[model samples]
Target: MSLRSTMHIPAVPAFLDSVRLRDIQLPLPAAPDPWHRLGKPQPCTASLKLSYSSAIAAAEKDDVSLSIDYGKLFRRLETDVREMAQHTSSPEHPHHRMVSVEGTRREEMKASAVGQDPRVTAGIVANCGLSLLDETAAGVRRMSHLRQSPRNSFSGSQAPPAPQPADAGPAPITAEYGRCEVWLQLPKALLRAEEGLKYRSVTVWGYNDEAGADALESESRSPVVLEEEFRIEGIRCYCILGVNSHERVEKQAVIISLGFEGPGQLAWGSTVVDTYVALTRAVAEKVDETTFQTVEALATFVARIVTVDFGNERVTVRVEKPSALPFVQRSGVEVTRTQAFFQSHEVAHSTLATRGEARSIEVLVGPASSLTLFRCPKQAALYPLEEPFIVQR
Candidate 1:
């Protein structure tokens, strides 16, 4: 049976265009803290003996107090560094590392480290000692003059060196937010229809705080870092919009659809899905409850559908409800559907086409499900010519 040209679909609201979108998926089994997970917990104690020289050894017996919670210290340092990394700075600005250490023991250590020799300072800095090696080396050099002065007092003669220039290379991209990685396939029919069309995909990685974003961006060489650190997964999806005409001036309504894997984190998945639904609804309200949808809205929708990995070029969509499962464990549903199902619906129209033919074609390719609607008469003709065209069940 032939398909009906126009159907009464429920109206979906439009969304704010300012929303961020991403298409990359992260891996799982993130890195564990070596010090916390593997280090042996031993009681910490230290005694200080100060002598001007062996001949002048002070007769005063000195008692020193020290206590260490190695695991807590390491965790605090890790969290601090991660937070510092999240600060957004132009590649030109110097990124400051701020830390807050409380408790009497930590306070005492900080006091001892202040204006002290590099070795003493290094010991007090906790887990980030290695990362701060360069700064520590510089600090040592600055303080060296104090040891050489006639009175053995800090002279403060030299000003610190200027901050280094931001690296000239492209910023490193990492999967610092996601745990799993999934692939998506474009239906054969959609592939043929959008053979040479150009579409852009963007991924914006956000964090609980600005600091988190900075940290992830700074450490990320790709999206994989998020998976490794957070044990979260990632997926790639495409936004297939059905525009009525190619003319930039023409305003036409388009159908919007998304293709993606099952949701990753249950809370995150629900939040993303709700956001997507809201954006789609808003766009539908703005354009004809039938036509135009922003790329941002569609991208946000697909971001929530991450479930499982179907290997290379297989389409999968996921839905998660962490709170819905018994015992409140991490849980979600993954639904696998071929790209062919989505491609049949996304249609594109162009003004450049001859009366009976389409002017141009654009296809949405990725791991998620998307919609392609026909906007112009010519597009309507080209929509069905694709290989693996959809067969209405």
Candidate 2:
């Protein structure tokens, strides 16, 4: 698909169509206290795409049985993921809480202490004071500072990392807020010098079981599987975002995460710095202006802002409400949408009514400044975007 939304002629045949379901929410069990120790539990957003030419046969013959039924697949996944999330995130699920001082070491110490004379033991105990690290509360709040680098993020070491575990404290150690899984696949032929060729016949798509797994593990494709991605996290904003009576009147704090995929490169004439400034401002503006009844609604709305207004092929949005559940760190939903998605659906939003007469923000035609978004210095240049965005005061 084209990276930017424009009227275009598709070069590929119709039989090569793929069915994709993106950004399916799977709530995870709460993370461990000192949440990164054994495993971190956090809500996860996932995507799945199945590319096969069998769909063409079904379409050509109008036979429903020959092709995939996306609805059935979605419902099954939803049920399974929801059950897993509920089981894992439940407070009473079988999880070892903080280990108290009664392990084998304590038992050994007791045995050794039994043989010692009371006077000598008392004297030794008195001489050396027993300083307890256990008495101090766990600094759960400080975990926010631990994941400053991308390596610490839980989502991907290859693609852009997702948000790590964070909590304000007194919240269970199991609170996991942000993680994303995007398992995407394109043809292996994309790496060749002369690109944009379709080699596969629209009539077939599968392989022998062993050969298929082996082909996936090939050296050239193994590492590069992480798709070209652009992501921004921790966009803190306030809006009405729940079904509760009080939630309807009061604006609550929400952290939104936004990201999109490009076809290896960016749109023509676009720069990473300019895209970031423009998208960040646009997301903030849209988020602040729209009031959503649910986190999922908020996620979808933000996704439309990127895929429609911003003209990106695929975009994902995760919206978290910090105050929703006191026991969990943050609860939210994530969604991924494309330009084609908006084309097929009618999005009726009461929150996005037109404001007063609009005026266009002019592009910078003169000397650039430190705050300029028109161009980035040579060192930071990456990706292409359509037009220049004006970053005002």
Candidate 3:
């Protein structure tokens, strides 16, 4: 039937509508008793009463218009119910389609999502490890500022300071000097030699001064005045001789002195002597003119000695063979002297007379005539003068 016609059909209850009746007749059963099954047994009333209520109700209420309207409403309701079920169950409905589209779009969005770039974060971590920043947040801010700032602004400032020079001033002085007093013990064999044959005992009195003159000269805007003194005491040997006698021997005694010279030119009071008699002999041989020449030569020699280290200085030397007549059992002599700007502590035979022997010799060096002495014949006579110095052991 057409949908419109189905909607217009007369109403029928669902129970009654589902029931069906056969169109054909059935044969009757043979009677069992003669009393005859009177007329056909009353229709099965019990079945009719239990299962045919809708049909009975329909038969009792016969309003054609109302039935027709009810049938139309029921047909419409059924049609509406069927359509609702179809819509709820179908996979292609608008709601289901919309959900599928949404799910697919969500998956696509996830697949297209961009991963984070780690270059900037990695740079920040490295910078922090190097102590360039306290944390990642601060590092990021700093980088941002740096990117935005002008590059040339930081490059225009002044350069760092330079280091100072080393040789900018005069150096400090360290040289030193002094004088000394010494005693010497001698051997008799050494005293018997020509140079030693004049003394029985010997004494040494000397001074030393080292001014570090080089340093003073370098730093001083003006000239420097330097003075020094020394006192030294040590055991040594000497040869002694009588004032007039030629015989000599060795004796031990304390020697003392007031003036001493460095290895520089000999001063006016430094010398080596053994006897007054020998001193007299040496003096007697000198005429006034010869003595003058000798003195001048001696001065020149001293100057030569002193100037060996410093050219701008003068020195004086003296040799005195003091008489030993009263102090010793025999007669003898002692010698002493000084020098200025001396350069050495050693005494050489060549430093004294070229014809006499020296039992002991001392030298002073520097501005402070520091005194140094030698008692060994080989060392004291290093210059090998014709006269040898008597050095006992």
Tens digits of per-residue lDDT for model 1 on 263-322? 222122222322332333332332221111233333223322221111112223332323
Better of 1 and 3 by TM-score: 1
The weakest ten consecutive residues by lDDT in model 3 span: 42-51
Kindly list the per-residue Cα lDDT of model 3 for residues 124-219, writing each as its tens digit.
111112111112224334644554455634554544333335553221111111111111111111211122111111111111113233432221
User: Where does model 2 exceed 4 Å of error?
Assistant: 1-226, 266-274, 349-393
How displaced is residue 43 in candidate 1, in Å? 33
TM-score of model 2 (CA atoms): 0.33
TM-score of each: 0.18, 0.33, 0.16
Off by over 4 Å in 1: 1-87, 90-333, 337-341, 344-393
Highest TM-score against the true fold, candidate? 2
The global Cα lDDT (0 to 1) of model 3 is 0.23
Q: How far off is residue 82 in model 2, in Å?
A: 48
User: Candidate 3 — number of clashing residue pairs?
Assistant: 56
lDDT of each: 0.25, 0.39, 0.23
